[model samples]
Target: MGIVLFALLLVAVVLLEVNDSFLNPQFYSDTLRDADIYNFALNDLPRSALDEARLIAPQYIDPSLDENPLVSAGLTTGDFVAALNRALPPEWVQDMVEQVLDEPGDYITGERDDFSTRIQAGDRVVLVVEEIKTLTRQADAYNLLFEQVIFPNIEDALETELPFGIDVTAERVAEAVRRVVPPEWVQANVEAALNAVTPYVVGETDTFEVEVQLSERVDVALEEIKSILLESDAYDLVYDEVVEPIIKDALGPTVALPFNITISRVEITDALREVAPAQWVQEQAELIVDATGQYVTQETDSLNIDIDLRDNKIAARDVLVRLAREQFDRVANDLPACSNSQLGSLVTSGLTSLPECMPSGGTAIEDQVRGVVSDTINSLQRQIEDAVDTALLAQIPDTLTFTDQTLKDQLAASGASDNADLLDDVRRIIGEGWTYTDQDLRADLLDFDSQDSVDLLDDVRSFLSDGWVFTEQDLREQIGDADPDVLAKLDDGRRIFKQARTWRFLVYFPVLILVVIIAFLGGRAWWGRVAWAAAYLTISAAAIWITFGPVYSALSGGGIDRARQEAIDSIEPNHDFANTQALIIDKAIDTGAFIIDGFAAGVATNAIIVFVIGMLILSAAIVWPRLSEYLYK
Candidate 1:
């Protein structure tokens, strides 16, 4: 009994803590918060309807329903009671009594006759008592029927219908629509209507009422606004600026597109192919940019762009105007063959409609090509940095810092005096030179054995401070001669390294304290604690693994890659290489990590609930006998 009571108390405390502290502002931000982080989660984003329901659900219990206006106006508890009393008059009460006492013969009189002598002085009192009991029973029946049948139905109907009267006005609807639409769309539309009536407008003040009546009409009005802006010619310039780039990215290579590709086709050498298959594509793009850039630079050389603007170079806009003119000159003078009939017209048209955001009087084509070149180069640079980082990490010692002194000590202890020169050669190659052989690396390690202990407390401290994980002993064992199995376990354990220690306090530590209390409070009775703790940890860990691993991996590049492949396959159904969407396919492969993380996290949380239930049953099965034995002993 004591154990059961304690368990119940502990459960109550945990529930209280979760509800009053953890859930309100944090975990239960919305039904959808956790779900948004990953899929398969309960959509907890509180809608207006859900909030209203929560407020109203508790009020259902009150018979008076005083707080609710509609309920107060209708048949509440007081009103119902009053109505019942009025319906039952003196004659109605007496009739109820006669019905309860009805008989073919005079049975009431017979009983009365038998008790006549005893009740002679109180005959009037006996008749009053019979009448009271009969009326009481009838009132009770009427009250039960009214409450259970009629009142609940009425209350439910009111609850279902009341919130509809909370009107969403026209102003509110317009405000919501304005906020929901993307900013770029709004800006583009506004620019298009430069000379026309304002693109945005509010109709009647009762926007919500209008939505209820003619919502489709509002949509048509919005479309008409957009169409009017398009007719004004102001939108033509802004639309072209935004749509051209979007089309280029989304549609891939197309002859129908306005832009012409004059790639300086180059022969692919064996050396170039070995280094980069995309080299031809990159070189061609760069050549096109350089040709245009040189032409503009020469043509604009004599033209003085404001020296103040050049010298100060305060804003991007200041540099852009000058650069555009330079690019225009470079394209016309340096690349004679690059000029097209459309180049002059496009530049003139583009500049004539330049917004404050657009650059003026320069080679727009060259500027765009330059941006493309810069993007491609930047991407290549990042790839190089990533590759170098991977290589550098593989090379570094996790525990011991390398130096001449350490190297000399290692060499002396190895007892390879004949190969002292060989040691020097290996060190010189790996430590000082750009390249190293496998033999050289292995020979250097021959001197390092299991017995050597290197202190790495500083490294561990740094890792901890930086929200990473490394321990002195763990580092030593990994870098030194730890057993392969031990190292593997340590490696597997390192998964927790990236977790924010601060978050652990908020999410896991409270549950941990409860686990400890449950396990140890009853003198080494660990069954319940072990089972529940293991279950919780398993679920949490699984959630982390799925969120950060396989699901994340699947969602990352995998989904994108699949989409790309589908796109590519459509392009050329039979030709394997030609059928894939090259750009999207590349991106999918590159960005797999992020997508997989979100998917995995959601799956893991759902799995935890199922696992916890199983653990509870197992806890009961294992602990019951042990508990009984402990009590008996």
Candidate 2:
């Protein structure tokens, strides 16, 4: 009877193992894949790696959406403060102020047309300002401006503008000349100098040339001057020197001119006729000048001097500007580099323009460029996220179907039994983790980790790293359905998490059978055998609690509640995320969560049923103790 009872326990345990794992539909490869679906959703894939095999799903599901993927991925600004302080750059007003009043420079030498002579090197390239002479002699506004606004404004304009090696001191020379010599004497001397500097009389196509040496003092001083003039600011000085003089010269005490300065066209045309080469050219020059003056005066409506002084030699506007450029270039050309900078005081004592041009920041380009940074950053964030999603999800269906097919092939090859489902169950448990023994096989609770919050798939895959195929093949050979042998030079591999309780249901059944055999041989009564069997059951219940509860907890680590929370809570949705992206993410989370919960509950339920059975046995053990003395009597 005891042996018969032991046989019943063996049957019960086998049934429990089959119901919990070997026969459960969720353990099938296709069903277990749903758990993979859920986790891929909640976690971001950018930092993760992709699973290659699960790229494709079976054709029975939607080709695009149904693939269960294991993402085995390793993976300001201030507004204008009170508007005006920041409205424009701080140097703008100064720039405009400096523009009207310029600086002066020392004239040097290059080449210029000098009809009066055959020019050569080392000769002064005298600028014959015929138009300036005409304008000044006639009291023209152009002449007045040349003496004040234009003259002073450009005192150092060319020198400052040209960054070439030419170092000039035209401003200093102009000041020196003004201080030491009368204007009439210089003019008379300049006329005399022009004739003396050249060997021929003035003609139609003569050019002038001069050569000059650069002094060490000039070069060293000019370097300092250039730096200084870059930021020299004397708008007040400009007004006082250039504008004030103009005002005083024009008005003499009142705003209006002291004399009637009538610089009319008749006066200009008559002057050009006096110098005209012939009568026809003179007539043509007058006609051209008249038309130009009328057009210019009409368009501008200021400085109304509708006078034509067209000459065969040159037009006043064209000739004067060219002459000025030539003069500036002359200072630049033929300038030998300075000897040395040892003459520091000698060089720098003469630099001027202290109140005009200031050296400073020119203009800030980034003020216009910084606005686009904000948009670019946001776009980049979205792009990186999207790219990761694309790469990770790119071949999901392929990976899934590939995995499924590979698993199916391995299962078919095992040749364990004709029941495809049973073979699949064997494959899954063996796949989940390495089975240590037949004892491990029968112990459903031994297949999981002892810790919580571990990724079930990764942990199993890592431990069962030989993969389901090789490990299953080895384990299957060991645990064949008939006459299994657990021990014999087995390689206990690198990692092992848990072991089956040695005194589990299978061992207890056999031990019970041995006791029953001993009782029968010793002639113990049937009632005594029954009482001992019941008493053993009472002791085993405690073993069940000790042995089973924690095993169940370990197996149930992949609980549905935990998985569901990982999914649902992760869906604390991104309101602005695109609708389609959000939908797929949320769905995957749910599917994964549900699958895990199902797995955990299935494991826990198995544990509970076994525990309850133990309790029932305990009650029987209590009853048998009460009956023991009665049976013996």
TM-score of every model?
0.15, 0.19
In model 2, the runs with Cα more than 4 Å from the true position are 1-40, 43-523, 550-633
* Segments of candidate 1 deviating more than 4 angstroms: 1-196, 199-600
Model 2 CA lDDT for position 193: 38
In terms of lDDT, model 1 sits at: 0.34
Instruction: Please write out the lDDT profile of model 1 over residues 210-286, one tens digit for every residue.
Output: 01112223344344333333333322212122222222333333312001111110111111122322443334323
How high a TM-score does candidate 2 get?
Answer: 0.19
Give the per-residue lDDT digits (tens) of candidate 2, residues 1-633: 444544454444544454434233224433434344322322332112122223424232334322232211111001111122222222332332222221100000001111121112111112233322332333333333334444454464433422112234556534433433334443454444344433221222223322221221233333343333222322221222222233333324321111111222222223323344454443432332333223322322222221222232243323323333343334333333322342233234422211111112223422222223223333443433343234211211211111222223333443312433454443333234222332332243434543332344234433333222223334336556443444222222101101222123453455456556644554466655544554544344334444444664566555644764564555445432334344455555556545555554544455455456655654665577678768998
